[model samples]
Target: MRVNKLTIAALAVVAGLSLTACQNDDTAGTGRSDSSSSSKGSHSGGSAQDTAKDSAGNDSGEGQDTAAGTGSAKNGATGKCRTDELEVTAQDGTIGGDEDNTVAVTFTNGGGRDCSIAGFAGVDLKTNAGTVSAERSGEPAPATVLKDGESVSFSVSYPANDTGGSGVRVTGLVVTPPNETKSVTLDWPGAASLPVTDGSGTPVRVGPIGSAGQGS
Candidate 1:
């Protein structure tokens, strides 16, 4: 009877040890599965972050390109009118009365781009006596922008002597556009004789540049 009891106790102890070994194996397997899942999650998060960074980088690059394009456009804007790019002409007309003779000087933009002009042109009548520079009128001079093939005009005015023999004989005109140092020479559009003064004895006056047909 004593031997049987001892045998029973030994069997119970062996069973308990086997059960503990099985529990340990299950815990280890669960820990390995949790570690693998965590590693995969970390890899997925890293990939997402990388993708977001790349998208942000692309957006930043595009913004810089747009700004560069705007700067380039500003650098390539239209400039001021040049004397060599204009075609100038003169025509004869009368104001107030037939005795008040006027010369309309027209400037046409012959360039390929738009340009600006303002104020009075420097006008000097080439006379047999010498060069007579014109006086500016009190009219308001505004800035004028001229596109390709567009034209602007100003006026040079003097009274007709009609007395037949007491005036300057103007043979030509030397015209310089506003703010320009160069000049162009054109033939006088009126009779060779021009009175240096008006009825009030005002010297020859020049009007401000204006749109076509606005001269005088």
Candidate 2:
């Protein structure tokens, strides 16, 4: 009976130790699972943050590119003067015989914004006989900026015919501003006329566009 009691006690002790060991192993496994989950969550959060940062960087770059393209388009649209924005006029500069006959043609910016002009203007002398296109003078054409309500002028020169019989009857003048395609017509300065040619048979000439009051 004593041996049996001792054996029973030993078996109880062994079973308790085994149960405690199983509990410890389960708790350790649960702890390891929780740690792994936390590590995975941390890695996922880092990846999300990195993705957000990359997306923001890409968005910023695209924004800059879009702004640059818009600026370029705006400049291309508004940098040059349009034909409808200008008011053209012509005045006789020097119309006489035996001299260089010149007409002062002015262009006023009637638009609400500033614009630029460069190069020579296209000029045509309209006569009862036919239309005569003017040649460009040998002068440098500097780019000029005209503010709203500002003006620029150019000169149209032709050879004078001392013999009045050889002159053409000028009725009107067709003027086109620099870098423009549309044209404006103005009645020839009162009672003015142009000769078909001087003794040298020189063609009508148009000077470059210049500042106001400084006819080119």
Best by lDDT: 1
Q: Residue 112 in model 1: shift from native, Å?
A: 0.5
What tens digits encode model 1's per-residue C-alpha lDDT throughout 1-216? 999999999999999999999999999999999999999999999999999999999999999999999888767756778899999999986656453578889999998878989999998888877777888877899988999999988888876767667688988988999999999999999767876554454457789988323444
lDDT of each: 0.84, 0.80
What local lDDT does model 1 show for residue 63?
A: 100
Off by over 4 Å in 2: 1-72, 75-78, 95-98, 198-202, 211-216
The clash numbers for all candidates, in the given order, read 0, 0
Find the 10 residues in a row with the least total lDDT in model 2.
190-199
RMSD, candidate 1, Å: 12.6
lDDT digits (tens) for residues 1-216 of candidate 2: 999999999999999999999999999999999999999999999999999999999999999999999888876644787889998888877733425767788888998989998898888878887888888887888988989999988888776555667478787899888778899999887345555564464468788887323333
RMSD of each: 12.6, 9.2
With a 3 Å backbone cut-off (N, CA, C), the pairs that clash in candidate 2 are: none
